[model samples]
Target: MAVTDLNPSDNDQSFRCTGALTIGRAGSTQRELDAMPDGMTIDLAGVDRMDTVGAWLIHRTQRDRGAHIVGESAAVKALLEQVAAADHPVQVRPDLRPAPTRALAELGTWTVEVGQTLFGLLGFFGATLVGFGNVIRRPKRFRMNAVVSSFDAVGVRALGIIGLMSFLIGVVIGQQGAVQLQQFGAEVYTINLIGRLTVRELGPLMTAIMVAGRSGSAFAAQIGTMKITEEIDAMRTIGVSPVEALVVPRMLATVLMMPLLSFFSMLTAIIGGGVFCWVSLKITPATYAMRISEVVPLHDLDVGLIKSLVFGFIIALGGCFQGMLVEGNSEEVGRRTTNAVVQSIFMVIVLDAVFAVFFSSIGWL
Candidate 1:
């Protein structure tokens, strides 16, 4: 490319650019153009070939130095016009908001998310109930195999961990209770503390939390994977109800097995507490058992079993509901799985508190 500057008069200067004004010559051409005085005329009538880069260079010179473009070719003129038209300001960063305004906006967003989740959960619960009704009306359609598999997965396999955890917890409670009660010379009441607390409160609550982490997260991951793979949709296309095939069996298994798990947890914890009493307090195994039976009332056992059933339902419902809500990609499966565990545990704790108040008011305390 060649660039020539001409001055016919002191007040008249023309910067003439010739040859190809394409990307190949852009750097050199731009350097030459940069030396031109402001408000000079840029004459491109001698330009043989031009491209977008050439047009952009011309547009920039015109914008920055108030230079008038004088070109002859229709193609060059169109390219320059197009490049100038396309150029516009773009905001690269978002505007910052005031602290209180941002806080309120975040609160509003959170409130809306909570409301949507609650609405969706209610719909899922209704669908689950309808699935149960369909099974009742057509018992042959029920999935016994799925229920058995779920029982094995959620209950039988979980016994080891639950039993071990409960045993450790019982020992800690027994040791701590004895420490405090010994101060008042009533260390024997440690039996009451261990037995009552294990059977009535800690047993079911701890089991629910563990199950939420283990089986509830599994439920969400399993169903969410099926959703991402379009298996749920394929089932529906084949006239198979996903709720009946996928959800009902898991729900039934969880509800049925929870009571058994809770009972086992209670027994293991009491045995642990009894062992601590036998070892530390010089109490016999028989005496510890007798004291536990006397101190922990029957109503307390009922309270625990009842809470186990509700907690199990909530765990199953939360996991399956969040799983069904999964969309888009595999990353969503992990997110929904975490949500399932958190939602299940939170609901279990909240409902446990409600049950405690209701039972106490009805004289079950």
Candidate 2:
């Protein structure tokens, strides 16, 4: 195209076009437009043909409707008009409500979001239940390998950390109780305190918290990555239900393993407390053992194990739910993973309180 710049700095400054204004010549046109000042007139009557690329450049340079266009054909004028129309700013009225009203409005929005999330979780839970039913009807369709892998991932691999944490907690409880009871000369009751606390509360709660941090986050991260990569979509396309293929085995494995893991945590914690009491408090191992046998009821152990079972369900549900919520990118995967951990821990504590109330009412506490 041939172009002539006419008085580039003045209102009459303009250029004449003589060739196709296509993407091929967009760069050159942009440079010419840039060299001119604002408030110029655009002489487009000489343009052979202008496309979206050319129109966009014209729209950008004009900015505030200061540039007057003297165009040749109907199509070119229409294109320019279409492009320029989009530049008009949308008008939005201000929200003039008081601060309290806005806060309530925001709270409503957040409540709606939370309700929707819970609804999705309930639907996913039902789907997982259906998946379980399908597997029961056709056992061969169930993936034993995945269940075993989950066992290793959530159970066997987690033993060390859970064991260590529980042991230290027991030691702390034992030592603290010993110190306080020494004042009353009831130092022997230190084992009583440790046994009741560990079996009734600390064992299951600590194990569940540890598992939430480890396995729950893993579930969210793994499933979320699969979603972001479209692998979950691929599973659907191949007639595999993601609920069956991904979530059910995890649910089963967690439910099955949580009690066992918590039992291990219980034993380790008792051992740690027993050792501490024996060495630090002059309480013999035999006396500690006898004291626990006489004081801590089997019902307390049952309560903790039952709590662990419920906590397992909560942790798995929270992780898988957050994972399914993920969309778009790796950033979302990380976000949902964190949500999984936080939600699992929160739900575990809430359910623990509920169970505590129920147990208390039933005379089990």
Candidate 3:
């Protein structure tokens, strides 16, 4: 074992090494001395035993700092040569790359799986349509308790959130309308604008969104759990159609409650808009009511009720489809539940847009 300090120039800079450069102790020493000034080299000839680590340190030091190793013994040089080879191993090309046909085949398989899932959804909807006949023939067999529970879950539990959201929406609509009407000295008309918009569009749309988040996800998770736990299969074995026992009841519940929820939402939003008009627009409640009476027709409220009924069906159908598709385990239940909510909400929005276009084209607006 030996140690040396080499100075490259008159500057206060040098390299130092101590003891034999073996694999066990070389790593720490290399790290310590690797940060020296340029052109400093540590001699290694006195090193008696050397291994891969010692060789790697020398190789790295030379590569990084342009340092040269001097006075290396045969054993040290042999080890250094092996480390250099290992550090910079020769690259070898594969005998053959993946063929274009193979890539295409893999892509085709993935596309087919996606297509199958979509077709499965279509099949489920078709089956439910057919199952409706069965439900009608034996209506007494349907679980009324479960249906009422689903109704309460979708409608009653959602009232607070829907009411608060509708009120805020109403306030925004009133403020926006008031700004434009105030410019024309017709600020009282803000109530008409807010009422018509809320009853004809926003009320049903907002209520559907609330139910999509609340009841839609619950339906998917409940049915998905049943599927995973073999409860769906048990129901089938006991002469109960899963569609009627689970899905039909939920769908009916949603359809029954959606219009009621929409009506409640419309009332709240109208009240909220009136409040905003009274405070900010300096319009009295009586004047606002008179304006709303003159502008908003009964048909606008009817359109909202019809849209809520349609949106409710869509939400429940989406949720039930995803739930019936759930397989494998608990994770599948969660995955399908999330899919149910997203798909239901998207469907609700798309249908709302379609309704808007249809109604506008028919001069309903």
lDDT of 1 by residue, 1-365 (tens): 66667776676778888888899988988888877788989888899899889889999999989999886489888888899899999989989999999999999999999899999999999999999999999999999999999999999999999999999999999999999999999999999999999999999999999999999999999999999999999999999999999999999999999999999999999999889999999889989988888888999999999999999999999999999989999999999999999999999999999998999899997
Candidate 2 lDDT, 290-332, residue by residue in tens: 9899999999999999999999998998899899889999999
Q: Please identify model 2 stretches exceeding 4 Å from their true place.
A: 1-43, 53-71, 89-106, 228-231
For each candidate, the alpha-carbon lDDT, in order, equals 0.93, 0.88, 0.84
Best by TM-score: 1
RMSD of 2: 4.1
Per-residue lDDT, model 2, residue 163, is 90
- Candidate 1 TM-score to native: 0.87
Please list the residue runs of candidate 3 whose C-alpha ends up more than 4 Å from where it truly belongs after superposition. 1-118
Number of clashing residue pairs, candidate 3: 0
Q: Model 2: which ten-residue window has the lowest total lDDT?
A: 2-11
Residue 288, model 3: Cα distance from true site in angstroms? 1.5
Q: Pick by lDDT: which candidate is best?
A: 1
